[model samples]
Target chain A: ETAVFQTPNYHVTQVGNEVSFNCKQTLGHDTMYWYKQDSKKLLKIMFSYNNKQLIVNETVPRRFSPQSSDKAHLNLRIKSVEPEDSAVYLCASSRTGTEVFFGKGTRLTVV
Target chain B: GQQVQQSPASLVLQEGENAELQCNFSSTATQLQWFYQSPGGSLVSLLSNPSGTKHTGRLTSTTVTKERRSSLHISSSQTTDSGTYLCAIAASGSWQLIFGSGTQLTVMP
Candidate 1:
């Protein structure tokens, strides 16, 4: 069983459309993060949420937003998706700097 | 921005052989963690070594914080050990982690 779950393992959509990915963790971790893995398999942090605040990576576009309804869930929304936005988005959670558990990741493709 | 660099982008090792991966950081780090990602899947935590050396099973990790370098040693490699190994470090005063591109290792039987 997966402690961290992601919905819609794969998504294919048209350009200029909106998309959202959902992630949930049962580990009871206070901090959650979103990472983007490019075609070259390079992983980069997009955003991190802990309790009351969300920290966005400087390189993230303004159209990308992270929403956390509660501690166990973090959702990523992209507006006016572009072809460059196609990648695998992974969700991870950890307590402090300890071990992190990652979801299987949702692959997004824009056409 | 802090940078994490891993050496030998890809490595091939025979079964029962020993392998070592290295990671170097650009800035002072408070936490250093290693992870393994299987082919086409999610990542799993391997070890968290901020300083000194740690051993688990056939894997051992040693981190020399002052030198800003860390190494992961795998003994008696098996085909199941073929995967990408990642190194992530949390720079001092920052809660976010910076990850290395990773070292892809293939252990052949």
Candidate 2:
């Protein structure tokens, strides 16, 4: 069973369109993270949220933003998506200094 | 710069064979975890070893904090074990995890 849930397992959208992916965790972890896996299978950390406060923000484009309504939920919104944005987005959460639980991931395809 | 590096970008093994994967980090890690991703893209936590050795079923993980390195050993590899193995480390005082480029394993019968 998965403790982290991501909706819209796969999404396909055209360029310049806005898209949003939702993620929720039932693990009661205080820290959550978003990572992007590119075509080369390299995972890159995009954002980290601790107790609903932004902690680590990588050098991601301004078009990408993380929205957290509560500690259990973190949603990703991409504005004017581009072709290069096509990749698998993973959501993970963990308690401070512990192993993280990850969602199955949302694969986004920009055409 | 990549903080974590995984050796042998890809590996192939026959059923019943043993496989070893390595992960080296650039800094001291407070938490180190090994994860397996199936071909379908689901992530499963295999082991978490900051230091010392830990085992689960056919999988064994050994971490040497002093050397900032870790290794995962799979005994009696099976066709079902064919997938990607990823190593992640959380630096001391950091809330985020740095992931190493996964090592893809292919087990054939």
Candidate 3:
């Protein structure tokens, strides 16, 4: 029973190349988030959107941004990705103050 | 700064044994959830207990908001249960969840 979904399970690109990941949730959650899990398996929130509005923005790099066309859809875009951008990007959703569900995550590798 | 710390970074247990994992946070959490990381690196939500105790299958999670800590108990360990357990806390008035370093569990058959 997969609810939250992310596209491109694995991706590889050059340092200067641009990459984008798409995510969608069927749980009808009000809040969606993007988290970066580094090689050390440390998860950190990068962006949070509530009902299509950006609510929380962490100290992520300028090349990273989140786009939401609606409450159910959230996308992550990295412009001119750097080698350090290689990590697992996970998309999640929650009904405000409740348990959060996660997607399978997209693994990005920048050479 | 909001933080989450887990004890006994790694645990190894034989099948049919039990395991206890702990999570301590720095702030008053509006929400506390536990997750299991799969071999594929995806997170699977196991339990969400803001306070008190909650149970699902053989897993139990207890959180004491006043003390700002939570504990997860696995009654019967299995080889399939081997993975990383993550604890996340959403600080008061925030939707962003700060995650702990995670506890790696290895159950041997």
Per-prediction TM-score, chain A only? Answer: 0.97, 0.96, 0.95
lDDT (tens digit, per residue) of candidate 3 on A1-111: 679999999999998999999999999898999999999999999999986568656479889989989999999999899999999999999898888999999999988
Q: Identify the superior model by DockQ, candidate 1 or candidate 2.
A: 2
lDDT of each residue in B1-109, candidate 1, tens digit only: 7899999899999999999999999989899999999989788888989999999999999999999999999999999999999999998976677899999999999
The predicted structure with the larger lDDT, 2 or 3, is 3
By summed lDDT, which 10 consecutive residues of candidate 3 chain A come out lowest?
Answer: A50-59
Estimate, for each residue in A53-105, the C-alpha lDDT of model 2 and write its tens digit.
78656589999999999999999999999999999999999987888999999
Every model's TM-score? 0.97, 0.97, 0.98
Q: Which residues of candidate 2, in runs, are more than 4 Å off?
A: none
Q: How well is candidate 3 docked (DockQ)?
A: 0.92
- What is candidate 3's CAPRI-style docking category based on DockQ? high
State the TM-score of the second chain for every model.
Answer: 0.98, 0.97, 0.98
For all predictions in the order shown, the interface RMSD in Å is 1.2, 0.9, 0.7
- The local lDDT score (0 to 100) that residue B15 gets in candidate 2 is 99
Mind giving the per-residue lDDT tens digits that candidate 2 earns over B1-109? 4399998899999999999999999999999999999886778899989999999999999999999999999999999999999999988878688899999999999
